[model samples]
Target chain A: MNNEKIRNLKTHAANIRKGIIEGTYAAGSGHPGGSLSCADIMAYLYFEAMNVDVANPKMLERDRFVMSKGHCAPALYAALAEKGFFPMEDLKTLRHIDSYLQGHPNMDTVPGCDMSTGSLGQGISAAVGMAMAGKLDNMQYRVYAVLGDGELEEGQVWEAAMSAAHYKLDNLLTFVDYNGLQIDGNITEVMNPEPIADKFKAFGWNVLAVNAHNFEEIDNAVTQAKQTNNKPTVIIAHSIKGKDVSFMENEASWHGSAPNKEQKEKAIAELDALLKELGV
Target chain B: MAEKIATRVAYGNALAEFGEDKNIVVLDADLSKSTKTDTFKKKYPERHFNMGIAEGNMMAVAAGMASCGKTVFASTFAMFAAGRAFEQIRNSICYPNLNVKIGATHAGITVGEDGASHQPIEDIALMRSIPNMVVISPSDAVSAFEAVKAAISHSGPVYIRLGRLDVPVIYNKESLDFKLGKGIQLTDGRDVTIIANGLMLPEAIKAQEILKEQGIEARLIDIHTIKPIDKDIIIKAAKETGAIVTAEEHNILGGLGSAVAEVVVQNSPVPIKMVGIEDKFGKSGKPAELMVRYGLTPENIVEKVMAVLAMKK
Candidate 1:
């Protein structure tokens, strides 16, 4: 990827982070920590990697993205808004009753969302389904999914992983946002999904571990996933619980809790500063 | 008289017939042979997906395929498909109202010898409770084939309950009108109405024969579709007949009995009796013996019809 394109993506990621903080803050009940953690990955997929149409999001040939860790919808919604799927102003309506931006990614209401997913592990299954459909129809479009590291505790993920590999879905790519924090506490303490790459490899996936925050690493992994022809790929992205914000980073308590006004302002300020640093 | 055929075989045959549609894709959770999806699989090997023993994953996969504009039919045993993968069906398929057909075989106590664990006595209840779910329990082979076609033609999530045991066909293919959400009146009477679905329809017909012999003149209605149930026929039957008896191979608590009661109690109150497994489980036995033991026989329907008729004002 070019330096200018990478800079633009970084700027977009920072803005997405801002949107996540703003949305969760406005709703007063949302998952900001995981959302912030996966903001960069969502940014890379929507902005740089996936072939999606902002004008006609329902286009059949467009690549599909399933946010398996659906509680992190704030990140996906924000990325969609930044990618011009919707207006930026709608981000504030995150979990509000009237908002189409639900607590989870609903494919019907949300323009860019390929699958409706909220419950853990099921989204990956949906991704597998989409990939299988694409293969069956002889469609050229690829499928991508984002899963939470904590979400790995669900057995359905393994089942999906097995199916994807069994079907030899090279068109499918998944990212496990290994933030090390779950709703209860540290992922290892609560339920260890470590050796995540090994598990995927065992299940016949082309596995890769990357620094989630690093745009270059994320970009390289996407390229590798596309290159691998026979099997599905899973990029186990090492990330902090909350990447940008000071007190929120690595804090398990922030996993699903919305940021209050003070926390929101601080988080947004940090993101804004990061955006400025990226020369946006 | 129609030939005797198992609903599962009929479903398989229907699926093969429906396989002409390129959009139709079939997935089985390693129960293709039993669920009858193997016919479809054989016909359209590329379109069919054997999802192994993962019902939950199979459901989500079907939902995924449906979302992508493919009409997916995911099949497995009723206990596994409806019971094991309840949440997946609720969240992935029904909630979204995707065009995924859950072809669940071996439903109710007729899944004999496998006993209670294999027999799903509450699959109908589980499916009907969910929103945007069309529940179809065809009476016989002709109806099962027609139901399969109807389900494929209609757009949305449909749960087609198929049985293991061979049931005598009730409807001739040429004359049959297997409309979704509409019940077919087989015999007319004034004493009582016998509403039945799935494998219980023949028994209900037999009960009608017995009722006629006794000068009871019981009406027999085949309620193929359970959810978005044929309310008008049920209400009309309740008003005209004054009493109703619901028969199914499932538990009395839910399934056809509860569904009919829900419609009748609100629209037109009547003396109703349910002929089914009385809040109990099935045991390891022959299909015929199990039917007798579980109170799903013609004698049971006759008894229920008589009981409801007695309570009529």
Candidate 2:
């Protein structure tokens, strides 16, 4: 990837993080830590990797994405807004009774959401299904899913892994946001889902690991996943619990709590400074 | 003796017949043989996917396939589909209103030797509670086949409850008019209404005959679609017939009985008696013996009808 492309991805990720802070702050209660953890990946997907049409969100040939770790609706809503799927001003209405941007992703109401998800361990299976459908229809569209490291404790993830490999769905790509922290605390303390890569290998998936904050590594891993034949690929994205935010970084308490006005300002200011540094 | 065929067998046959549609896909949770989705798997090997004993994954996978313009039929035992994977169906399928049909077989005590663990007496209740879910309890082979056709024609999530036991063919395929949310009236009478579904419908038919022999005219209606239930038919039955008896192979709590009473109490306020398992777990026994032991026989329906008739104003 060129320096300019890298800068563009970084700029999008920083803005997405800003949207996450703004959304959770407005909602009074939303998951920011995990949302920020996956913002870089969400930015890479909507802007760099996927073939999504902002003008026609429901285009049949468009690539599909499932936010398997769906508590991070702020990240998805932010990415969608940034990608021009909907108005950016609507981000403030996150989780409001009348807003389509729900606490979790609802594919029916939300403009660019491929599947409805919130309950952990269920979204990957939907992604596998989408990939299977693409194969059945002989469509060129690919399906992508992002799961949390803590969410790996769900047995359905393994079930989906087995089926994806069994069906030989080469079109499906998954990312595990390996921030090592869950709502309770460290994933190792709560439920050790370590040997995550080997587990995917055992379940017959092509596994890769990358620095999630680095857009070039994400791009390279995605390219390798597309080239892999007859096996679904899982890229373990090593991320921080809260990326770029000063006080919230690596903090498990920020996993589901919204920041107060002062804290929100600090988080947004840090993100703004990063954007300035990127010359965006 | 009337021709007997398990509703599961009819379900499988219907799937195979409908598998001709390129948009149709079948999914089974490693119980294809028992649930009778094997018939579809045999015909369309490419379209049928066996998710290997994971009911929850199979449901969500079916939802995913449906989202992409495929009409998917996901089959499993009732206990697993409605009990083990209730949340997946609620959130992944019903909440999104996907075009996925859940063919839940081996429902109720008629699952026989498998006992309470395998039998899902509350499957109807569980499925009925979910919004945008159409719950169908097919009475016989003909109705089960017709219900499958109706479910495919209808867009959205549908839960078709099937039985392991072979039931008497109650309706002629040529004559049966199977609509998605409509009930079928089998007999017309004024004294009492006997509304039944699934395996209990044949027993209700027998009870209707016995009631007639005893000079008591009874009405018989088959409530195949339990959710989006035919309120008009139920209210009409309650108004015309002063007394009502609801029979089903499921529990009396939230199955057809509760659905009928909900409409009756709201519309006509008729005296109603429910003939079902009395909120207890079923024991392992011969299917016929279990029916008799659980008071799910024609005699039980007859007795309930007589008692309900006494309560009539």
The two-chain DockQ for each candidate, comma-separated, is: 0.83, 0.90
The 10-residue segment with the lowest total lDDT in model 2 chain B: B114-123
Tens-digit lDDT track of model 1 for A56-94: 998999999999999999999999999999998999998
**Cα distance off (Å), candidate 1, residue A120:** 0.9
Which runs of model 2 end up more than 4 angstroms from their true locations?
A: none
Candidate 1 residue B231 Cα shift, in angstroms, is 0.9
Predicted complex 1: DockQ: 0.83
Q: Across residues B1-313, which tens digit of lDDT does each residue of candidate 2 receive?
A: 9999999999999999988999999999888899998898889999988899888999999989999999999998899999999999999999889999999999999889977898788988899999999999999999999999999999999999999988899899999999988999999999999999999999999999999999989989999999999999999988998999999999999999999999988888989999999999998989999999999999999999989988998
Best candidate per DockQ, number? 2
Model 1, stretches more than 4 Å misplaced?
none
Per-residue CA lDDT of model 2 for A26-93, tens digit only, reads: 99999999999999999999988999998899899999999999999999999999999998889999
Interface RMSD of 1: 0.7
Model 1, span B1-313: residue lDDT tens: 5578999999999999879989999999888889888898888888888898899999999999999999999999999989999999999988778999999999988788988899898899899999999999998999999999999889999999999888897889999977999999998898889999888898888889988999999889999999889999999999999999999888888789999999888989998999888988788999999888878889988887777877999
Q: Please state the CAPRI-style docking class of candidate 2.
A: high
Worst 10 residues of 1 chain B by lDDT: B301-310
